[model samples]
Target chain A: MDWQIIVDSIPALLEGMGLTVQLTLISLVAGFFLAIPLGVMRLSSNVLLSSPVLGYVFFFRGTPLLVQIFLIYYGSGQFRPVLQEWGLWEFFREAYFCALLTLILNTAAYTTEIFRGGIQAVPHGEVEAARACGMSGFTLYRRIILPKALRLALPAYSNEVVFLFQSTSLVSIITLMDLTGVARVIVARTFDVYEIYITAGLMYLVVTYGILWVFRTVEFRLSGHLRDRALDPVEALKLHP
Target chain B: MFDLKGYGWMLWEGLSITIMVGFLSLLLAMAMGLIGAWGKLSRNKAANLTATTYTTVIRGIPELLLLLIIFYGTPTLIQNTAERMGFDIRLDFNPFIAGILTLGFIYGAFATEVFRGAFLAIPKGQGEAAYAMGMSRMLAFRRILLPQMWRFALPGLGNVWMVLIKATALVSVIGLEELMRKSYIAMGAIKLPFTLFFAAAMMYLAITAVSMLGQRYIERWANRGIRRA
Candidate 1:
């Protein structure tokens, strides 16, 4: 309830917000690119192509992200000598790199599934129509299927983005000075845990709402011609009554 | 290249704690979900608004941040309020209790949506038919609505449960000595982070795999007598 404490802490918390936003943006971009091929592999008929992707998705989604973060950050240390020999120790040594790597891998798993769902959801008839027009292989996928799948994937992908943003908070545990980490530090120093946490929570709320707004705008733009202009009276009745 | 000798008991104990917390929180979340769904569906504006706000705020923030707030901030707030009331008392949170409460409350928001959607999927005519048969609202709900809602809610709730199980790991960060904490301890002691955490990950995957089997059974049970697409 102390307004002054929250106000005074804004500058410090905003600094942490920078790192949080950076982590989310970088991982989401990297994960998005990596997930495309993985998603395609996930839908393949060949066991060789599909099973590994399945296992990757299962492992990442099955375990806690915190555990994954710990495994990558600390577990990498156990292989320090091997990592050094391979010249990868330098990348693994920095907490920032470790956090970024974990985020990218984790998000890639979830995004792969989302993309696969979207791809599968592409209409069968439309695909056939494209084939009837003699469109085949890469051109068919590029010109027709991929665009629709991306559109279909937008809502779920946005949810993943929100979840990913919230998850960046976990990097604070690895000693990254993200928003949550800075909040913890401030609370420890000032013993004003509630106020500081509330402030941080509000900052998160603002960011999340902002993300929602962007997704809404994107959905609105992409949904043209697909969305019903008028609500169905029967459906409305069923919902309300 | 590490050994787990003499650490079997510790790991088992941690697994038990993880299951314990997961079970208790699942129960709490189900209870919250029921109440939350009722509130949202009720005719009262206050009830609807309260449910809406609860789901919105909880879903917006990070679960880890919420866990920390509940674990560290609640007791301090309570003690300070008690002092202001001229009562000298100290309050402390049991990490187990705090973990269950926070996780349950957080997941409850998600459960609310699941239950709400499930309830809505049930046709209004079924309840109306019961009422026309001289059945009271409570009886009508019990005999007509609950079973079907369970059927519709099962898959969504199953996904929530899977996430909830993994979320128990967050409680370890609050010092609850769950599976993740045990792995951390073993890793620190043995200097074998790779082995310990890999084992922990395997244990989690094992639990999730078993849960998937259970979910498939429930889904089959729920879908019985219903036509499929």
Candidate 2:
């Protein structure tokens, strides 16, 4: 209800928002690329190709993001000598680097699972059609499967992106001044917990809706052919997200 | 590297607390989810709007923020209300109670979607047939709808449980000595963050892996005598 306090907090909060957005976008892009091969491996018929990816996915998805962050961030310190000898200590030493790495690894696993589902859900006929055209295995995956899989995976992938965005807040626990972190700092100083948190939550809500809007537009464009042209946009938006 | 450093009992106690928190939250979430599903599936406009708002707002915010809000907001809100009523007394949130309530509320929004989907999956004719057999509305729901809904709801509920259990880790932020908190403490005590946290991670993975196997058996039991699609 302290309207002025919420207003006073926006500038600082927006600065925090910058970090959140940075972490989310970087990790999502990195994770997506990492997931592509991981996903393909996950769907491979060969156990050797698939099982390692399975273990990676199983471990990441099975544990909490917080634990992973702590494990990577603080855990690396325990291996300082090894990391230093390997010249990897510099990377693990920065909280930002550790947080980003954790988010990337975490999102990659979830994205791999989502991508695998999308690939598996791709019609067999399509793959067969490409094969009949003498498309090589790599070419077949590139031209036929990846496109459809990406399209099919968009909604789930978008959810992952949004989740990743929300998750960037956790970086604050290790001293990254993300949006939630800024709000927490302000609240600690001012004791205006409700007002500050509400403002932060509203900021997150706006970004969440914005992400949904972008994804809906992309989804609409990607799957336009499969959808009935006469169906209203409002109706389509209601189906998911 | 695999040593627990005499903190094995600490972890066991913490794991029990973690499971307790997760279980209590799941129960509360199930209750809310059922009500939310009813509200969503109901014809009443107000009920539908309320359920929709709950899910939308909860889903839109980060779980950490929501947990923080409840952890800090509850006592403050209570005191302000009491002040307005001419009596002011401070009330502190028991971290366990706070943890379960926030997690339950958050996951309930998710479970609402799960329950709604499950309810929608049930055939209309099955309920109609139950009614035709002279079952009252309540009887039809209990005898016909609930069981079938359970079958359809299992996989989604399984996913919810997976997420919810991991989410219990967030509760550690509010001073709860759950697995994550205990791991942090042990890590500090032993100066072995990698070993302790890795051990903690495996403990979590064990919980989820076992739950998955349990889910498979439960799914089988839930779908007993049903034709596979």
Candidate 3:
């Protein structure tokens, strides 16, 4: 490994880190909101609303993120005339926005399912007791249901967040100069693929490790009220970015 | 507003290759997953560490990076090793093999967790009871452990299978004629990216729906005894 070359490229690579964090943070925030309604629909008794949501989750989860990105970026481009007429062309024209939209929708579909599991895991007795206390509708969901589901869902949600962070690298293909993109650009110039890639890999390791640390601290704080705490540092690292 | 007039045959061709790659890699991933699960669960510390590292590194590295490394770096590495050993061989990697290896490596990491969880779910006393009945270790594992583990692992394994099926699309970046690559070609040829890509997405949805049905049947079969009870 050429240590000097890696040292020289850090500034350029760090520039791409902005895009990486941007994609991850935006998608995570968007996906969390999107997942709530979609998750409720997935568990809904009504088939009309639920089925479409089910189909959406199936479609997104079943296809690769790369294909979805291609479909959104290239596929949307083919509909330029229609998009222009509808005044939506501006949104699709920006690769960064399109990539963000894809990641948001894709992660939302998966997180919806995860959250659905969490919602279902919420004990029925707790809901009934809350209802007996006269809570209903949004009040019921906001106070009684959402809090319990979040607690149940935190572990899986943490993993999803890490996966989303790692997945931001895919945006590089669509012309967003993320970390991976910068590394590739450096490789094309320097022709030293291994050193540059190792640098990128190490960068990911650091980011992922940081994510793992945050999750552990949060998990530890969350379990502070519980009787038995079983958060293993090593196991917690697996959930890191 | 959709035009499917001229690209019918080409779409079918692309779908076939996509299915081919997905199935081939599915088989390879399953085999690797089994071996990886064993390696992870073995008593040997080195085996456990190797499996853990393999899963962690492979999972952390983006699929595109792995494809790029194998495609560009593997050949160079092979050529250099050959030169140093006084061999006049210029080694070439098959794209299909590379695709399978990459997918297997990715899915094997997930399968290790599924299989480990399943093995842990099985009560240890069952294995002890089997041994007390004069059964060999292998036989005890085959009869007492494997069946129950499979049942417990089916749901998790199913999720991994779904993940692997989707991940196969990444292999198209390496110039493979899987559905995504084929759709790209058709889109390029006709200048209608939406139609071709939509058709490709539908094909993927069809495959996904079918596999889900397959998973349902496997789950049913695995739980047959429990259902009867």
Q: Pick the candidate with the highest lDDT.
A: 2
Better of 2 and 3 by TM-score: 2
Q: Over 4 Å off in model 2, which ranges?
A: A229-241, B131-136
The number of the candidate with the highest DockQ is: 2
Model 2 lDDT tens row, B1-229? 7887798788888999999999999999999999999998889999999998998898889999999999998889888889989997989899999999999999998899889989889999999999999999889988899988988889999989999999999999999999999988887788888888898899999999999999999999888898878
RMSD values for the candidates in order, in angstroms, are 2.8, 1.8, 2.6
DockQ of each: 0.64, 0.78, 0.50
The positional error of residue A153 in candidate 3, measured at the CA in angstroms, is: 0.9
- Each model's TM-score? 0.96, 0.96, 0.92
- lDDT against the true structure, per candidate, is 0.90, 0.91, 0.81
**How much is A25 displaced in model 3, in angstroms?**
0.4
lDDT of 3 at B55: 74
Taking the candidates one at a time, how many backbone clashes does each contain? Answer: 0, 0, 0
Clashing pairs in 1: none
Q: Kindly list the per-residue Cα lDDT of model 2 for residues A1-241, writing each as its tens digit.
A: 7899988889999999999999999999999999999999998999999999999999999999999999999999988999999999999999999999999999999999999999999999999899999997799999999999998888789889989999998988888899988999999999988999988999999999799899888777776677775345554444343
lDDT of 1 by residue, A1-241 (tens): 6789889999999999999999999999999999988998899899999999999999999999988999899999989999999999999999999999999999999999999999999999999999999999889888998889988898789889999999999999999999999999999999898999988998999999788778777777667776686334233222220
**Candidate 1 docking category?**
medium
Ranking by DockQ: 2, 1, 3
Q: Candidate 3 lDDT (Cα, whole model)?
A: 0.81
How close to the true structure is residue A204 of candidate 1, measured as C-alpha lDDT? 97
Query: Model 3 off-target regions past 4 Å?
Result: A46-48, A229-241, B83-89, B133-136, B142-144, B227-229
